[model samples]
Target: MNQQQFSSSHIPGLDRFWAVIPAGGVGTRLWPLSRAAAPKFLHDLTGSGQTLIRATYDRLHPLAGNNIMVVTGQAHRDAVCDQLSGVAEENFILEPEPKDSAAAIGVAAAVLFEQDPEAIMGSFAADQVIGPDDVFRTAVAEAIATAVTNKIVTIGIKPTYPSTGFGYIQKGEKLEIEAAPSAFKVDKFVEKPQADVAQRYVDSGQHFWNAGMFVAPVRLLLQHLQSNEPELFEGVTAIARARVAGDVTEPMAEIWPTLPKTSIDYAVAEPAAEAGDVAVIPGDFLWDDVGDFAAIARLNPAADESGVTVIGETPRVYADDANGVVVTDTSRVIALIGVENIVVVDTGDALLVTTTEHAQSVKQAVESIKAHGDDDVL
Candidate 1:
């Protein structure tokens, strides 16, 4: 993929920051194109010639230097190592199975805290598409500054429109910190709202789309997890301790799955926000989680006069009047006649046909296929 570079030396106070990448999830909504064996983060959904995780590494390595760790499933360990040559073996935290973000991030915090007492860790998803490097770098630099003051800081995307798919972060009082002048106290986190409610939030100018990105001192996170989720904290901490002692193979296998299956939002962010210990950095950049084909359509390059936005096999797709997204990894010609807002994903083993309106329900289709006992297709 084409990439832009940013100089970390120019930024202030990013020296002690370490980037933690949580690379899990199969991205079911973009199914057929995104599968179990090779998940979405492992693919170049943007047709940028670089996979999502690789792009994430490229974005963060300069800022964090060699202090980057990728927490991913064991099934993807080899691929993760292959793609990230700069990341050392010790920096790769391989999970036996999926335990969601809480466990994935918790372990990294615990380990980093032990390694460097002054370490501040920033946790970013491997699959998010970030636009405008300057904006992202500015936001992250301010976030790191805020985190040094011992606050759990999350970057909130400035809402361009009322989006019902993403959760909202309600910004409270403006913080008076010079390092992070644009930071504000997070009032509360609202779950993905109804259309009307989302519109109201947009009108109020107090809400930003939750991007699930956080920066905090490793000490702060470990302490919070220890107080709020003692059992989980104990398990992951034990795993980290075992790693420090040299053999984590056995303890990680035992403790990882035993940790609770929940998100970091539910585990820490909500409670911390209630206590006024969380801060929000207003992110003024184009960002997309790329949750479904509809989101992918918007991120793709603009469509031709015929109106179809195409990715992958661009030369093989012929659009007459179709006006949505068309993705193909196969050799067959994909001809779109008159379909509007439709999604056609052509893969070798299976093909998916749906509309942007119904793209979120494609997960249901995967379930239906599984119920029919076609594991091979999945």
Candidate 2:
């Protein structure tokens, strides 16, 4: 993992760069805490003062400046705007429905292409927690430089472990681009593998976790989309043209909800990789999608010898000899005594009590709640 690292001052920021944040996911894994209306990205999961999206913005502001656009569902438009007053009203790209990453990022790409035909945009998740801000920014700067070559570039996170929860990107020979010395050809993009298979991938020392952060020229991205998915490409292009014309309301309403449900990986990345049109830069910084309770616990500074991580502003949690976990989102007092390795999440409406081992099953609880017709809690 001896990838090149550069100081933030050394990395050049492109004026044509734009950051497209696709912010629409319930994060059902962090149930009770993460709701459909207010998902994980809207919350300060890191216990940092800023919300996840805000933190993401802060991290990218140095690289992309005010050239940022958030692509979110119509339902979340107000929240996204309220959370990001620094961004202009026109910068927000509200989708009519959730059509997954391809549509969301594609629309952003289309709009950026309209603004600047050669715009280089990086699509970063609104909810990821990076290990070091500098390393992340440095990797992105290099990715942007690499993207200028008209190739799809992604930050290939050096796999810390055999993580079954994340997709893996296999790297090929090193790219000889002087501007992006650490860049490499993407051999393949593999889906989430079984535990044993994940271990084998890690043991081989040729795989990197797919960080879901993609950087490329807008034209190149749309060209790939048009080549692999004409229908989707046409839909986004039409919407983008309307946006550029300043009358997207009617066309977007008619076009967005009908787009197919597909992730960027399946829709473009895989095909581009197959065509030898993708590049990956090794990223050694620690990155976490904060997918589950285990990942949540890892971010808690309070997870001490007793193992307790209390979230929220004024959560009244008292742990006497409690050893496991206690998370509260409300003002009500939660007392945990002599409990070890157990997770207690008390939202105002719903409460989740489970063990750390079964934390991944929290999504099942959300489904059970839905089955019980309790959408308000969700």
Q: Tell me, by lDDT, which candidate is best.
A: 1
Model 2 weakest lDDT span, ten residues long: 1-10
Sum up the clashes in candidate 2: 1
lDDT of each: 0.88, 0.85
How do the residues 65-119 of candidate 2 rate in per-residue lDDT, one tens digit apiece? 7888999888888888878888888999988766789999999999988888988
Output the number of the TM-score-best candidate.
Answer: 1
Which ranges in model 2 have alpha carbons more than 4 Å from their true place?
1-13, 303-305
TM-score for each prediction? 0.95, 0.94
Please list the residue runs of candidate 1 whose C-alpha ends up more than 4 Å from where it truly belongs after superposition. 1-13
* Root-mean-square deviation of every model: 2.5, 2.8
